[model samples]
Target chain A: MVRLITHNLLACHAKGCTQNNFPLQFKDVSIELKEQEVNSEFVKNFLPRLEWKALVNTARQLGDTSLPEELPDMVDDDFLKALHHVLFEIHVEEGAMVCPNCGHSYPISNGIPNMLLSEHEIG
Target chain B: MFETPLTNIDYDKVYEPAEDSFLLLDCFEQEYQSIQQRFTGRVPVVTEIGTGSGIVTCFIKQNILPHSIFFATDINPTSCSTAAETIKLNDTHETHPFTFTAMQMNLTSAVRSNKIDLLVFNPPYVPAENVPEIPKDLDDSSWLDLALLGGQDGMMTTWEVLNNLENILTPEIGIAYILFCARNKPDQVAETMKARGWKVDVVIHRKAGWEVLSILLFQK
Candidate 1:
């Protein structure tokens, strides 16, 4: 399941298209919430690894606008819970992750997001 | 390397090829240099679940069988990127249209069902009561828990894999290689595979530190 955790690391892999390729925009996304044992520590530890802006934007795109626009300087329990939900619970069941740079689109179906690109797109 | 392969990997982030990883690679190497015969006639559709650093899959594709498709999946998004990087770095002929891609997926959930010719996995097999629950210590960022925490008896994830073995494997030609430690109970796991009518073998094993890790191969 592609929560923002997975989406946060994705970038358009189209050859020669580099800048602004990151954080592929979600289109027509349908999310399924699968509850996970909230790990406050894991979330706090993982926050530094995330692209904060992309995460917030993705949560909104998926219709979970509970997150603030900015990451709090100190990650509290409430923030950790929210981060855990955003990272592990949300599943992108069906959608198209459209590249912001080259406009390349990777489709997600049955909860598995396909990252394979065509010959021309292979970097 | 998508960026860096074999070396310079941030092991703290993506899984570094460890004892289990080496054992899995040795099995493949031995298979390639077999004294006997071919397991399957055709080129296989290859996949590796939880391909932390993508080294094992890359080794098979590059040195062992250079002309085949490769699919690697990981739950950690960073590992997927790391796997892709490793694939790009290790591929001898990238223009071969190597259908090499790394995906963020749980197990083989996103894979083409039952079409795998050669499937590989070195899962979390460490025994712990609170297996899936991340530790309460905020400073503990190590992903080993995610990669090594196998519930009580260390077979929680293994059972899930076996439960779907029939459906996950190709009807006639699927093969899977999995890693298990002494705590994971290789004998019992073999029995489970046998119960499912799978032909199983302990391909290779070695004593690494206090743990004895073995690789089990299942074929239809």
Candidate 2:
């Protein structure tokens, strides 16, 4: 349930949320990387939609220190492999994703995160 | 692939037949061969929207060339997991280069905008007399309500898929291969695709059967 694609759209849906709150930072997250064969075409196709800084930072927090600070001009096999690992392999089996601005916590259990907010939190 | 009529055999009998009866029929082997022929060349990235038992997926992986990447998805997580397990069972060597990711995703939310090359769907197209009783197995999830029912005319799910195809499919290079029933208004589907400016083709047509599975290719 915590796919990076879904993670990109999720924000702190709490009341009175404003300004740079989202792309919530992961807190004390546990990750497992199941390496899949790198598809350079897919990686190249999906690069535009990726949030470079957020992804790199999240990967770093999850103990993957392979990506560069900035995306390189020529994306080689090595870069794509790392990108693949960052995107698909790492599964967030446990932990909470906290919104830096609003201070909302989305908890993860059994690799599935409960994103539904309480009645009071609903806008 | 050979054409077979759904009415030729009793639905209930074939659905839950005896072990000895299945041995004589060899339905699995025939289905496997049909699936293999579909993915033999140019190894397209295939995404199955309603991969029920994962039989088709396993068949494709086993017989097709090694380069194809299969993403088997279902609205039901349990169904997705079952498919994933089947994939693991069939996959002997990791070096075969097949990656099967079973994900719980709805049609509206799951797929990225204008990204998929091919979409395979075999939705529930049997139109009901009244809103049929929601089966106990599907009561746990809300998706089954819309996913299985084809609306008043039994083409509701088919229409939904067509509407979605307009957005998810690129006019220049996308194609959606779907299967529907003969009693479920195939003309409406063809008309919808034509109205949406897609070149439609009837790849497979079965005679004297209620379940008429046609692969509609939507191209620019």
Candidate whose TM-score is highest? 2
Name the top DockQ candidate. Answer: 2
Please, what is the whole-model Cα lDDT of each candidate in the order they appear? 0.72, 0.57
Q: Give the TM-score of candidate 2.
A: 0.65
Instruction: Please state the error at residue A107 of candidate 1 in Å.
Output: 6.6
Q: Per-residue lDDT tens digits of candidate 2, residues B120-206?
A: 666656686543333335435433543456666777666777877866654455567676666677777788779878888765555
Q: Which residue runs of candidate 1 sit more than 4 Å off their true CA positions?
A: A1-123, B1-5, B33-41, B92-95, B133-142
Restricting to chain A, the TM-score for each candidate equals: 0.93, 0.88
Error of 1 at A15 (Å): 36
Q: Residue B161 in model 1: shift from native, Å?
A: 0.8
Worst 10 residues of 1 chain A by lDDT: A39-48
lDDT of 1 by residue, B1-220 (tens): 1222363367666667888888887788787754113433344557788888888888887766554446788766667777767766765545332346577656775343565667888888888885564333423565557788888788888777877888777677677889999998999889977987889999999999899999998886
The CAPRI category of model 2 is incorrect
